[model samples]
Target: MTAVTTRPGLAPRLTALTKIVELGPGRLDQKLLSEASTLLTRAGDRLKLSSEHTVVALAGGTGSGKSSLFNAISGLELSPTGVRRPTTARTHACVWGLEGAAPLLDWLQIQWRHRFARASALDKGESQLHGLILLDLPDHDSIRALTDTEADRLIGLADLVVWVLDPQKYADASTHRRYVAELAGHEAVTVFALNQADRLSPEELAELVIDLNDLLRREGVEHPSVVPTSAVSGRGVDSLKSVISSAVSRRRAAIHKIEADLRRLEQRLSQTMPVGQALSAPATVDEARRLGLTDALCDAVGVPAVGEAMENVYAERSSRWVGWPYPRWLAKFRPDPLKSLRLDDVSDEIRGITTGSVSAQAAEVSNAVQALADGLTAGMHPVWRTAVHRAARSRSSQLPKALTEDLTEVAPELDRVPGWWRLLKIWQYFLVGAFVGGVAWLAVGLTVPGQLPAALQLLGDSAALPWVGLMMASVLGLGALSGIASRNFVVLGASRERERLEREMRRRVAAVSENMVVEPVERELGRHHAFYSAMRGLSG
Candidate 1:
């Protein structure tokens, strides 16, 4: 190959390709990614080797005369042509200069016998086509499997492709659908040769060229080139050679091929995913949404219900402790609200087990979680939106267990009883005892009225009986007043305890929300951010 320099600005593009392959799988279609995967693997090997020799392939279907064109271009019968043979079963290479081409040819997997070097050009001083390696590929529509296989393999690796078509098969279905359409946006390194044009009249040739270009346009080529040619008469042969020579001299066709491949991959990727779509998504949950989620989860985990149960428990226990003696036994028959729901006296463990009775409706939890995912991923690309939503749902099945465990840990905080209740209990018992004892003494005094009245009169003269009666009534009234105050205080304490329980329970449920939903959503957004950043580097 010639000592020409390759194009600049290619290393960065390759780096961009590396970024895409590394970050694509989780966010890209694997089938589409397979194209990038093959291209990237091929590009790396190709870039490591020589860039001076621009490999161009002449590819077409059977009876297209591409083999004839290949022989005409080489000025030698390198590829045998016949009606029975139909197509080239294997690839044949013709190189203008042989230097630095062995490694490239080896990489192409071309056999040694099929290789040809033009030594006559050196003797004749025809150096115009120097450093060019033209490949005669097998027919795309050949009945033999090896022909199609070799054609496909060579077509993908070639730096530039020269499609050799004839008047009859220029718009063939197999050629357009399988090959031409696949190379849609790669128009830069593509050339179309309308071979066997001598068989058509001048008007027909011009019209065929127009029809062929129109067909190429429909296949996604922007400015399709249809060079009319005749291998028998050498029509457009020099023009095809000139096109090959121009690419060889500039030495950018290899780099341009990679660039075109990258563009095509990027275009297909964008069709499925809008570029920079992740940039607009919300990365952090707002305070309002956080509160909303916490509230929802709190309900699902039965935080508010537990808190209300806490108050009922606190009040019920208070009745046995501070209630007046006459009615304190009634509290024993009442069921503790907290115990009935299996939240009574939770163990002081981080992973306390609670019953399913505490859970809210399942649909309620699902809606809340979905809402949270939707809020965070607004305006995100479908790829990342799906990822974020999936992340949010990744541990959703564990939510009921997580919430119950967290609620259990927080449940023990409500069981603490105030110390004042104990002191009040002693005071209430003393009053009940005093009141009962005084009534019993009065009844016994009535049985011995004469002695009791004489003893009372001796202690306090004529007013002693009425004064003793008034003293007994005063003691009864004081006990009643004390009982009323105890009831009021118990209610106040229980209410305060309920409020405290709610706050603590909300905190635990919030922790559940973070693990089950918020954290996953954030992690997904992080992936999207990285993916988009890599895409930006690629676009540059």
Candidate 2:
């Protein structure tokens, strides 16, 4: 993968991987993650089994002399070498140290009959190779599928691999492509042995070595190790031994293998999860989308309709209390704005009450919510955008009842009487009383022609007719004029109430939108940002 002078430790990378997998549930490729998890678990189990013993497998395709190399290294013919179609079918393991190696061998699935222990080989100049477990694996390019499969499995478990190649098979593009190139990032634990070198002249041997090195360098190795070895002549065997000894001495082959494997996996994840825009803080839903959602909710719940209703209901109430006393009772005949929309009562005060009120059309609400999701996740990956879309609409089922409850809490009081209306009513009542008294006195004089009260005797003499009639006309006209003048005040108050109600409705609708849409979408974006951040740690 990535080159850094000093990288973050294994624990952090492992932690980062776990974070990525956890946060990537619906928005990442699960198959890729599953393989990473399996590799981690398997690597852990292998590391726990043995670290002192380095398990190095000799792997090569058909007729590559892998068995001969194994025998030459172990100083014994532990593996059978043959030629028809498939040779070295079963794996043969030779362990230099038997102490703590049985468990590792068992885990590798090596049969006891095919395993060897060199516990007494200290006197054969093999002390330097003390902690090594060399394995001769089956031919990977065998005609028999079973042998090929066995070789592939064992080679994957090996900490270090020595691939044998002869003159004929050194340039086999298909073989290297299928095996060596696939392990591109694992150059630290790999070596290619150019075996059977006795067949070529000195000049030809040098040319073959140059050609083999060139081939391997093309497969992602800056400087490939191609040791020329002849099993019969024992040439270049010491060089191969030196490579194995260095790995065993460090006792870090197993750790290196896991590290390389992790890099490969992280690279795979990087391909799918684009390194997002540099995020300096936790993600949030933008203000434009938030406001848009609130506006939509206001429309959906008919805030404008409610505002109009408020003004009508307020004006009607005002007229009932302050109108001319003669028509005061007739105000009740008008329709109440709040009651017409079925919004006066609290929606959930009683159980199982459904709202019959009109709201903005369903399509408008749906489109608004969709727009919010689209704007919030504008440049996100398709999978993450899908998650944001789902989050935006997650609570859509509760929108209707929520809007109804909010409207109920903010609905204006229809029965409330203004403080000044009562004063106006009393003035009108006094004028009406004066008109009634004047009418009664005149009527008494008319019916009983001369039987007038002493105080009203002048009005009965027919000379008081003009003054008495003027007095009654003045009281009636004053009451009517007062009622007509109050109309302007009533209209002004109603308009103010309508504006107040609209403001309150918009505020409550914004709260509903924040709860149902904006918050959920932000949470999904937060998850994406967290995942992206962790992946950056892996690169470092």
Q: Candidate 2: global Cα-lDDT?
A: 0.78
Q: lDDT of all predictions, in order shown?
A: 0.78, 0.78
Q: Report the number of the highest-TM-score candidate.
A: 2
- Alpha-carbon runs more than 4 Å astray in model 2: 1-8, 23-26, 84-88, 278-282, 286-288, 324-357, 394-431, 434-515
For candidate 2, lDDT tens digit of each residue in 1-540? 111111348667767777887786766778987876777676767757867788999988778888888999998988888775333358899999898888889988999999999877798888889889999988888778888888888887888989899898888876777887767778788888999998889999999999888877787666677789988788989899999999998887887877777787888887887776424433887777677888877777767766776676667567766777765546457676447755444222211112435444566677888988877777777787788889988987777667777677767666678778989888888988889987987787677856566536665565677788998898878887888777678988889888888888888888888888778888888887888878886665
lDDT of 1 by residue, 1-540 (tens): 333343555666667667777778877888987887898898888888787788999998889998999999888899988654544457899988898999999999999999999977767655877778889988878888978888899899999999999888788888888888977767779999999989999999999999888888888898887788899999899898888778878788888888888787777776776765566766667788889998887776666666666676667667767777666566457775546755445321212334434444566777788888888877888767788889988988878777766666556443456688788878877877887787787677667757677555555665566776787787767767777899898899888877877888787778878877888777777767767766666565
> What are the TM-scores, per candidate, against the unseen true structure?
0.75, 0.79
lDDT value for candidate 1?
0.78
Q: For model 1, give the 10-residue run with minimal summed lDDT.
A: 347-356
What is the overall TM-score of model 2 with all chains considered together? 0.79
Give the per-residue Cα lDDT of candidate 1 at 415.
47
